[model samples]
Target: MSAPNIPSSAQRGKPSAIPGSSPAPVPGPNRSGNTKTSAPHQEQSTAQSPQLISVQTPTGGGAIQGIGEKFAAQPATGTATLTIPISATEARPGGTPSLALGYSSGSGNAPFGIGWSLNIGSITRRVSKGRPQYQPRSEGTFARIERVTHQDGPGNVHWRVTSRDNALSAYGRNSSSRIHFASKGNKNIFSWLLCETYDVSGNAISFVYKSEDDQGIDLNAVNERNHAILRGSVGSYFSRALPPLDFDYIAAATGERIARSVVKEVDWESLENLPEGVTGPLYQWLDLHEEGLEAVFAVQGGSWFYKRNQSAAGTVSSLENSTLSRTVTLEPTKVVNRMPNVSDTEKPRFGQWDVFPPFELWPSGIDIGNPNVRFIDLTGDGRADILITEDQILTYHVSLGYSGYGAPRSVHKRTDEERGPRVLFSDVDESVYFTNLSGDGTSDLCRVRNGENCYWPNLGCGRFGVKVTMNGSPYFDRPEAFTQKRVLMTDINGSGATDIIYVRSEGVTLHFNNSGNGWAKVEHLPSYFLPPIDTLASITATNLMGNGTNCLVWSSSAASDTCSPLKYINFNNGIKPHLHVKITNNIGKETNLSYLPSTTFYLRDELEGKHS
Candidate 1:
């Protein structure tokens, strides 16, 4: 009847909908059948073009006062938009008062209202935004208080301090303070200091030095002052007043008393406090402790006495200079107690090193560090056993795994006088090898000399059978070259049987063993150049690469300083072979790895020196 009261394009600020185009509005409720009609004659327009929906009351006086879009066309695909103009009256059907679209209370079809639509579970009140409220903090008796500004929030922050706790220890206390004893980690001394905890603010000033005659200084007042109260020279002659004693703080600060302790000097003839068998005059010093002061008297001759907490009686202890070195020629620089602070209650009565179970030295009187003692495996077990040669007897200690070793037992004896080897060769011309020459996975002894070679097959349990004389070989022809270090035994060709390697200035000769009795094969690898005899330290044959074939690692003597030029020669299964030779020059000593036992092999890893 009234053309649906649609506004003009100019008034709505948009172009009219196309005649046959689809309504591309955003997806929402399909309010097609929900449109309202006022009068019986107000039959809904049946046109398929886009049109506005208008509502009227039963009296037909005024229609719902607003403009709204009604979907009369088909929906299509495209970005769609709708301009919702706020209405002063009812804008859309089912919308609340002053609202364009109605909101449902819950999942069901409930009508819209002015109240909040979101069902916040059991919450009945609305959430409003405001600054958080905090309960005020109680202010205690503050020694020093100040207002600290807050970085955030509205008001100026008011901060208060009650008191600062005193330091429990003087570990980091200032050296200038009289009450602050000299502690270990005082950085002011410029000395190297180490500590678990340190504070640069100095010790929390305490009342130990505070005086009552003069106005008593509070903890805050003392903390505010960092300079020393009394400054002067140290020792017997001081430019200022003497340092305050326990009760002298008040007198010292006010100059009320120049009281001093009685000084006494005793002659050496009256030294009745000396420990038994100890000579004196012992040098005395006051040593400070955490709990109290201690009087210490020590001497360079190896005796010390201590009186703890000013006690009348003192304790005496030995400060003997001890060493762990095996040699007696060179004197040690200094003796340091590594565990100096270990309490007496934690130490054994005889000392930690006095007696160790399971690892006790055998034979009772023998020195374990004796050069004649050797650690090796006579048995097939992986653990190392002990071998001691004294007089002419060879004593063996079988390893019982980690539990320690079995009792010492005699394994063998030398028929050629206890001096060494035979009188003809001497010890220098004899080289002995402990290896699996018999191919039985057990080590056998082989003695090689300039004139003759002997093989003693291991019978088991550290016992050997009769010695078999080996055929004379040209490898040991020179008595000078037949020394113990000139010969090396190893598994050269991945065979379980051991092989012998004879090193000389000219080259190296490798001999393959034949059933632990004789040499089956021999190969000579010429040296690229002869190594300097004085600089040559040792030549080792070990399975460096973990491969079955062993490698020759020649090292220079420790007397050589400069880098030793190295040449590597790999002899792989007798194929294309290479040799490694190192020549050293005078400069710095190189660490010799020959000290490592022959029973063990050095593992060659990727981290090995490229030149080695």
Candidate 2:
């Protein structure tokens, strides 16, 4: 679908499909669609509208309007969608759920369902595992926009639904003024517009309310609240099947639904106007049914930071220029801390040291002076120490607790090699290793002994070696058959023994620790067997999913169909690379990304963002 044009009377008149909605007979073509967005009211103050479509007030003149005060001007600039989070059962690292559906086993327990339009009768017939097996349902309309409510009956909004045989049914009444649409899919999520009925005097008698379809879970359960999304409009009435729920309904062009099922509400707001150009939904909240929490993540620009249990009215206040989403993020981290930049020594104190700004472990000059830099607590002081290994000498900036970094000290030195040393452990029992480009550089002296050096710089010299050490004591300096390949030292199996993994454009090579002895052998994991992870902006392998082995994450600018801008190389049993999935959050072009060990992968989205 093209970007949605700003919502206006003109746009409202055109038919729009309500995704993730109940399968109802939509009443027409593009121009005659049943769903409608209210047109912009004649020139009026954006803060407040000139005319108040007020429900009966005690004084009868006017009382400030509330429900839609935030989303009054949603003449949708473009159609938007919502993604409700399903099962995070796949959240890596120990089966911990990133987002989980409700789970309570009983006589009838099903926390997974989809927005569907099924033959109500058929669902009552067949049984699966002793339970009725229902077909996939859809919240899509089958009614035409052209055949609209030509007339308003005594108490219902009526439309004609023609069958496949051209047999037109009479008076499609919207009895429950609002046909409550529910999604039993994995979560108790449902939505409906403010379709209300006013008495002759304009008093709202009832609204379109949603409820649980089968299990009959309490719609009013604590921590359970609905977000009244500004889903355009539905003409002046709702439409559905006339009497019997039989045939399918097809209407306007539709869209795929979002799957973030959790959300948090708040009071303060970001004054920045809503952004345009994006094609789909920017979810305001997600309701994690299993965590028993309503949450919203903080987005400075593109990267998202987590925040929990935010307060929200779940209503939008529309304006002429943009919709005043009654949603704001509360940054619990330094991202929004208003404190001035103070020296590390002068920074104000916080409950936990982790609450401070993300500490810049690598100082300013490192990037310009060295290419290979790693942060680890070499002294095991619980503070991350910086290690720079660009040249023959390694420099260390030991952590000074909360005070600052200690002076840089020349710790270990090694022979020439294209790559720097990689640390396997940070304790007194440290194991550091690096590739030796030459066996003592003696081959360069023997220069092109066979012209093979012209094709392969380090060929036949057999000088290719992986030098290892325990606390700087040499372990292995043998010839490496697979030299020049990217080497990464990580504890792949989580067995406390550091291992080596070799990476090449074609595939990857694994060298596990043989009984804790270094680099004993190798296993090649070919590329054809894995998803294509094209030219990468960055790549980090860690137990992000916490499934035991390592999960590789990379940023792909090419963003092929299989690879999203933010791609995850998810592992199956923590041994070999398995499947690949994209993070749905819109983290635009990335600047930097790193794995914070164990499971967290930190991403630096658009560095220009003012947050912290």
- Using lDDT, give the best candidate's number: 1
Q: Candidate 2 clash total?
A: 71
Error of 2 at 282 (Å): 22
Error of 1 at 436 (Å): 2.1
Q: Which stretches of candidate 2 lie over 4 Å from their true place?
A: 1-369, 372-374, 386-395, 407-485, 536-539, 562-612
Candidate with the greatest TM-score versus the true structure: 1
lDDT of 2 by residue, 450-509 (tens): 101111111111112122221211112123333322446554533334455556667655
For 409-477, candidate 1 gives per-residue lDDT tens digits of: 884464743212222212444556666766656666667665556666654445565566655344543
lDDT of 2 at 31: 63
Q: What are the lDDT figures for the candidates, one per model?
A: 0.37, 0.31
Position 21, candidate 1: lDDT: 49
